[model samples]
Target: MEDIRDRILRPGVNCGQLARAHRAAVLIDGESYFAAFRQAAMKARRQMFILGWDIHSKVELLRGDAAVKAETDGAPITLGPLLNHLAQNNPELEIYILIWNYSMLLSLERDPNLRFNLGWTLHPRVHFHLDDEHPIGASQHQKIVVIDGQIGFCGGLDLSHYRWDSSDHEPDDPRRTTPAGDHYGPYHDIMMIVDGEPAAALAELCTERWQRATRKSIDVHGQNQWDAWPETVQPWFKEVDVAVVRTEPSYKSRQEVREVETLYRDSIRSAQRSIFIENQFFTSTVVCEALEERLREEHGPEVVIILPKEVDGWVGNKFMEFRRVNILKRVLKADVHGRLRLRHPWVGEQPKHGVMIHAKLMVVDDIFLRIGSSNLSNRSMGMDTECDLAIEASSPEQEAGVRRLRNELLAMHLGFPTDEVDNLTKETGSVVRVVDLLSDPERPDSKPRGLGPLEAQEEQFPELVSEAEIVDPKRPLEIDRLLDIFIPDETTQHSWLRAKWLWVVLGVLALVGLAGAWHFTALSDYANREVLAETMAGMARGWTIYPLIVLAYLIGGLVMFPVTVLIGATAILLEPLPAMLTAFAGTQVSAIVLYFAGMKLGRERIQSMAGSRLNRISKHLAKHGMLSVTLIRILPVAPYTIVNIVAGASHIRFVHYVFGTLLGMTPGILAVTIFTDRLLAFLRQPDLSNVLIMIAALVFLVVLTRWLKRRFT
Candidate 1:
């Protein structure tokens, strides 16, 4: 019988191209990949290329082993220090690191791009660039490491945090912690390490990316002819050929390649026995449609998919899983023969924050294996950059090797040995049946270790988040789509006024707020107005009063205490200029406080406090950045504190939000302070001193407004 892999593994059809790997191995999870990378780098003498969606230098490669730290008199085996040591020690070496110039929406989770050396400022040989050379919304989503063009590592594991776990995936593993000491849940991923032709190919591929990202070309033509593979790493396959494939989105001069998408469909059609998959996300409609095509077959191969139970303890946002459920509903509808099984890994008697499966892998017919950074999602199809490595067994021995790997992965999930899983599958006549027999979440037994059926459950999703394409787009974002999300067709130009008109409206509203507060507080009860004004002015001049005024704004904003009331009170109490300064300082401080609170609480927890309106601000922040924060603040679309909390939970940069708040709040704060102060003075006595003070304040505000408009617009 002809090998099914041979018919489908054609160049330019199923994949973009192919490259041979002399030796290949799969490193499971962060700990394995990190240690392997550290070992390989120690032998690197020429150059190293590090490319990722994110890069952090603070990640500790080795946790408990104080060998490297002890040798260095206490410096840990962190990414930055390791790279620095290699670069500084080797004169022939040049290191290039490229990371995505990401959206601020992920600002809280990711460390700031610390410019090449992480934050430590490593040797000058290290070159780092924050690559924003893609389409506006698309990211540079490839995570690859090539050392000296001799060995390469590629897959879903980035040199970032929230990725470290053993195969056991203990629920309370003490070692599962970030550099900042915050404990995170178990994370699972795969990294494919290859040496020889594949390594050189990866080096060449990412060098092109480097040139595209940094515009500095270096020669990667010559092979180093040295083996850089780690001695301790277990080799998955040897003396076998491997195919390298990719999904590179078209933008500018670059042409789009949907090879990964095509390869998936081709491989699915070629499968005869079973198709097994493990992935971080499962929202790809095209892949699901292909699965549907196969599922409709009366005696088609049984399908098994493994996914994370939820998105909270993992990398994705909540809405992606909500969309995953929507996709699952479609795929399950096509399963007429009960041949498809969706499973999630669990640790305890019941699932409590299930292990985060970050691996992107698939095996078909126990003869072909595919592993890479590409997820089964719309974005991973052709919108984002992706890379994958595949192998087709050309011999019976190699085919059995592939079968053994699939069984081993199953055994790891099922908490059994590879032989047991292999034997059980043969006995049950199907892999899905074996999984169903042992993989039970509803089992009454005290210990529940293994896979459980993946099901769609009711999720708490905010409005507009159900717009799936908005979150996981198949193409680069469109301005029309963003506009459609931000504005409705019914209310056109009139409701949202021009800049000048908006200022006039806000100014009038501020004056009304001052008058209402004065009346509501019964300020007329004071017998002598001059004496009352003098007493208030004296209180404002005291040093201790400033902190008190700021504290009131902080407390008032969080507890839904009306901000206008606090502003009006400040205006009534202090002199015009002093009152304006006080109001601005108070509001900025309160926003900063709420923003940090939102940072610690995260998005879902913030939703519990602020609700659906946060999505409105988040959507804006994603598209508009600083301008969105400014506009929302000026218009007061949601509560003052809610916007700040959402901004903290969103992509808006901290500096941008701070300055935007200042710009947006300046007009209103100035208006309330000046007008309320003048009104009180006028009511007391219509004197030239009060009149001159009001005129001077008005001039200063006009000048400030004109300057701001010219600078920003």
Candidate 2:
């Protein structure tokens, strides 16, 4: 039987039509991509628009010579300065940057001393807006640069701090800077500069994004934003076709396209000689499956990936990295000739202080180039919106240009020169041969040296583990192979057993909460009638009741009681605190009860009953863990009651479930509770001023809740 990779990579299979109608070229690296982008912005004749999930104005594009010094005191280059300079330099240039509206307060308080604060920048040529029109759970994640309707850049690199560094990837280079107060890590990224019909198509995409984000019309002009316009210029590539892929929330009749995944599939199917990739993640099973088939083919192209040893965040590691490592191990099993390699660049230490790779680039046989904001993971493919620019080389010259681009990227990785790369290629005839020659086991001292401030640091921080050994495609999946996907591993089972009693305790507490709410309502009504009447009279005078009602609901929600039941109980009792306490207690109990059901039913078996929707939910929960669960619980966005039940029946531990629920629900509960209490007080007192105060308090709580949710969840 043929191996998986062989079956996947066998030649002569035309999966689909290849669109070739435009030409494109652009040098991409952390610094160069930005420099080229800045140059493109300067040359924009008509309009420039940028959209991203997160945009920081403090990011500096062009570091000053002083940056090389360790002093850290020279004028900090920032995105604002660059845009300001561009707008000032060209009066006709119209630039708009739309960043996701994280929170109203955060945006206003970002930088008070900055000249062009995002909240208050008023340059006529430059405009900034917050994007908040998407559905509650969606984000605008497209990153694009359009200039003069002639050239455009679209890819994964964002205009943010910690994304700047030369391809040299120096270890201790003071020239490298990170906003997080650490030396920059090794990163790989890709972007395409498109001209001709493709450029026009990209320009149209920018216009659409601008309109969607800002609700305004943007006109494209022929005049360039550059200081002097060239009457005519030659095309970078003979002919190229670019497809504009996008994703947004389901709005009206429009459907979001899973462009990132589609592109990945197409690239995998079209590979001829080799498939080279650089990404922050390697987790998607579907993509891995395709690669696995290719690896089984005798003449299949070699697969190479450059990634960080680990992901950056805790949740990312737990959910994404672990899964990714397991999948890669399986893929390696199909590599009979050891044609697949996964490498993480290290400047120092076995683990600590090693620079993480975060670039995303894919090159296929010098015929196709893909650079974009998508990672090889589930989120970038379909969950979070993404955009990419793909250019195909149809002719020999175009293919050569593509090869040059690939060599430039390789040179950056190996710390060599363009001409040197060309010479090496001439001698070796392929990247694989050149890499092998440079990386000869016996000649470690003869490898091309990285230049600049990091040279000394590099020596101090030599590779502890062999790169080839770590990434050898011949390695078999070991421990992971013994573990079943649905079955609980030893750690998971231990965790569940350890936390089992907690669920029982919570269930009992919920009953107490329910009983308490009922008892309080009865007692308050029976004995506090006069006080209740007085409070009601005061409320009639001027106070609002909505705030008090909201408060009751929040307290009930936190305790795991039905919101309606808690509200009714509180109103009947005329005692806010008891009603709130009862509600809170009840909700906790409900969660406990649900958890026990999950433990008994088995998470996997229960999940199967719910079908794909629940399966997706399970994946999301597994990926994001307690944080995501808590977010959904507190917000009550996606059937919180059902989730509570399903989560209990799932693999999530009781402790995580409890902690996440308690923490995530706090904000919403507090806001509603405070609102309810204020409204109740106002209704009892009948003071117009009190009513106004209640309104103000309600608004404050809402805003506060929203802020807290964004910060933590």
TM-score of each: 0.66, 0.58
What would you estimate as the lDDT of candidate 1?
0.74
1-713 per-residue lDDT for model 2 (tens digits): 33232232212221112234354565555676766665555555556667665666756666656235413433324566667767777777788777654322122323322223442355688887665444322345677766666666677777866677776556666756754466656555666666655555666766766665545668665443343212222345666655555444333234545655766776787777778787877767668888998889897777877676666643343235445656677777777776776655554333324445565678887777767777776556544556766666656887787778777866666555778877987776566665555544356554333211111011211221222111211111121121122223222333323211111111222232233334435643533434544554466433345445444344434445455344343444445565465445555665666567665664556544433334443543566577656765665333344456667765576788888877765555555566666776887896988889888987787787677546543
Give candidate 2 regions above 4 Å deviation. 1-23, 66-77, 88-91, 102-120, 133-137, 178-183, 224-239, 245-252, 348-355, 416-437, 448-585, 588-713
Q: Give the TM-score of candidate 1.
A: 0.66
Q: List clashing residue pairs in candidate 1.
A: 104-651, 105-651
Model 1 lDDT tens row, 1-713: 23355577888877756677778888877878888888888888888999998877888887655334445533347888888888877898898888886543344456644454465786799887777656545678888999888899999999977876776778887878887898987678888899888888889988998876655678774346666789888777877777788888766446788889988988998888899999989989889989998898998889999998875422255347767877788878889999999888877654465878989999998689888989999989877888898888877877787888778888888877789889988888798987886675454642446887788776544332524454477876543233334433321334232111001111112222233334335652432335544555566656777787788789877864567667888787667787889889999999999988877774657555334334543544566667777766665334576567657876678898899899888777877777678878867988998888778777786777676544433
